[model samples]
Target: MSDHRWSPRSPVAALARFVGVPFDAQTYRNLAYLLLAFPLGIAYFTVVTTGLSTGLGLLVTFAGVPIVLATLVVTLGISSFERRLADHLLDVEVDGDDGGIELAFGSVEEAIGTTKRVLTAPAAWTGLLLVGLKFVYGVVAFTALVTAFAVSATLLAAPALYDAPGVTYTFGPYVVDTLGEAVAGGGLGVLLVLVSLHVTNGVARFGGFLTDALLGGAARSAEAADA
Candidate 1:
């Protein structure tokens, strides 16, 4: 078997890998995932919070039982979708049997059994937690990515914009006015973009990990059985 460790032959090879992050397909996928996280997170959070609050609030009435069950079913469905999304965009394998819950109208006993199973399932609770926290995760990711890309783009455009009338480009303590200074600022911008791509990849990996842990029902069950 060939060794595939991070044993680059030279400093130049290591630097090439670092600089080549933007060209990688996975990096773009990570960017897409992060970009989508904000809106999707908000949607998930809204649905989950509304369902849970409404269902629990009305639990005194007979309608509350069905509502809560329906909410759990919907949450599980969302979890399944998130798992698939992580698999597609982050290239993470989410392996496990999703305990399928089907409410049978024909038999009350079957319906009650299904309800019990869903209520006691570890996956259900974990999935709920994941959905609830998605809003915060989305906001952080969206803000970070937008800020990083915006700053990088601004710096990269400094070379062309610095000389324009009534325009001043400043990078911290240094002001970009001359062509040489603008060029240097542009170079720094390129470096920042590369760094941002790497950071984005790292963030995507963390998201994938969170999804796998919360949604991998079979894996969790197997570990519990082993214990």
Candidate 2:
């Protein structure tokens, strides 16, 4: 109880938070980040993977060094964008902090030097891996969030539609043909929606961790700034 990491401030408070769901600011912010993750994931996967493969292929001919460097530079830039996204949306620090992410290469010479550093950096590779994984998780998360919301909306509206002729909704082989059943379904919908908020929070935490581990902590913040 004393340690928030080990347990919630209070069991009751945790339950209340679960019930309150995504109505609050943090949850909404998490939801927004989740929605954006899919597209960003797609972009990350496409660019990084392409750059890696292209650079690797050209390596044999000595033509690949530049491509590899370019890829690293691009990924580094993308990582910076991801850091900004996490800092802005997720509950984390990315730039202008003790351990933050700030990658800005201004000159050709600077880019060349930065690229060399980025290639050998484990954080850069790890960050690329995280970016690739984000696409997969983002798809699943987006679907779940949308499904939860849709179900909640439909069930909440059931009672209003119950009086309509030939109106009936089925839930797991249970037909909601009466006002009472409709209302009950609506209540269930509410519960599911609340649960989904926690899911959104979990996903946001993951994104934040990835940003912190890979894109953050100022690898070249000072150098890039001076560049």
Candidate 3:
């Protein structure tokens, strides 16, 4: 006879895994990162778009050179911050060396060299690209989170709010007015909440991968070689 075991494929194991998702600390960290992404992404998008456009628009004049260089420097700084943020919240090891160009005022030659390096570095361009992409990612993440929570909350509270004046609960064509239906809705909400947590964590992992790829010097070099 085959020996019985608590395999992950078993129904009980699958249910336990689903139920435990929300209790994980990493899940909350992912949620916090996603929540912060929306506002931070908007800020990043505004700064990058304004700086790049203004700098490029004035490129015909001598003044445009410094403005564009300054924008690149600022972009590198933002990328550095993103690396640290991902390292902390997403638990990803983003490389410390982001091919940063150090500015030195010791001589005119040094300043010129730094500017050339910053303009040429793969990390700088990739970082700028990452910042631009972040805005889109943030919008999607925020929308998904809000929609998930709103639906889950409504379902979870259906039991108590179904009979309230001017309140009605409808799932598809079925009305959730009876106590049994309300309880069922609450159960569904629980499952939805758990599923949402898993989805959030998955998205966060993708964010971590993106951060590491763009912000890490080694990955940037590899990508450049591949290209």
Candidate 4:
């Protein structure tokens, strides 16, 4: 297994190291999980949003606020699903930190009470907010991912076919009247693809940071309790 552990005496350096990249096996696994998990999150958001929006719209009794509430409920389910997915995919040992979940309060009554406490807690709301943000982001990311791939591929390919001396036939909404234009457009497209890669990578890293913040429940709780 690869060791991703880094030595940083200070909090700031430690955070910088964590955010930059994983050098150890664990870090690599976590990063891979994060990358893969996002697409899963996108799919999860799409299915949930589509299904809930359609289903709730069908119900006449469900008004605007009710629909919002229903959506929130679905979002919660998605959050739980993603958490489990992350755990399984990353092989993250949440038990050590007791951050993922805690089964401290035993018995049905105690469990219910503890749940109520968690629900009412500010950290829980922050987690929900994080989920909401991720849902919106996932939807956008999925759209951009498809669009970028399509646009980049088409543009990069256009130079080959359209710029070819023998090939005159052009395609799509783009008007490549001349071979020069086609070749130029392809160059522009290649630049666009580089830009898209940067954007996607930025979004992925930002999403990972947000996930770390919102999903670090034990850390949040401990801090909150300390304060």
Best by lDDT: 3
- Score candidate 1 by TM-score against the native: 0.89
Cα lDDT of model 4 overall? Answer: 0.57
Score every model by TM-score.
0.89, 0.76, 0.88, 0.52
Write one digit per residue (lDDT tens) for candidate 1, span 184-222. Answer: 879989999999999999999999988887778545775
lDDT of 3 by residue, 157-186 (tens): 989888888987787687888999999999
The 0-to-1 C-alpha lDDT of every candidate, in the order given, reads 0.83, 0.73, 0.85, 0.57
Model 2 Cα lDDT, one tens digit per residue, 1-227: 37654366678777767776756898888888999988888888888889889989989998888777777667666766677778788868764332233344798777666666666554566566776778887788778888888878887777778668776666656777887888887787778777777877987898787677655544445447569
Clashing pairs in 3: none
Model 4 per-residue lDDT at 163: 52
Q: Let me know the TM-score candidate 2 reaches against the reference structure.
A: 0.76
What ranking of all candidate models by TM-score puts the best one first? 1, 3, 2, 4
The better candidate by lDDT, 1 or 4, is: 1
Deviating ranges (above 4 Å) for candidate 2? 1-15, 94-115, 216-227
Instruction: Give the 10-residue window scoring lowest on summed lDDT in candidate 3.
Output: 96-105
Which regions of candidate 1 deviate over 4 angstroms? 1-9, 171-174
Clashes of 4: 3
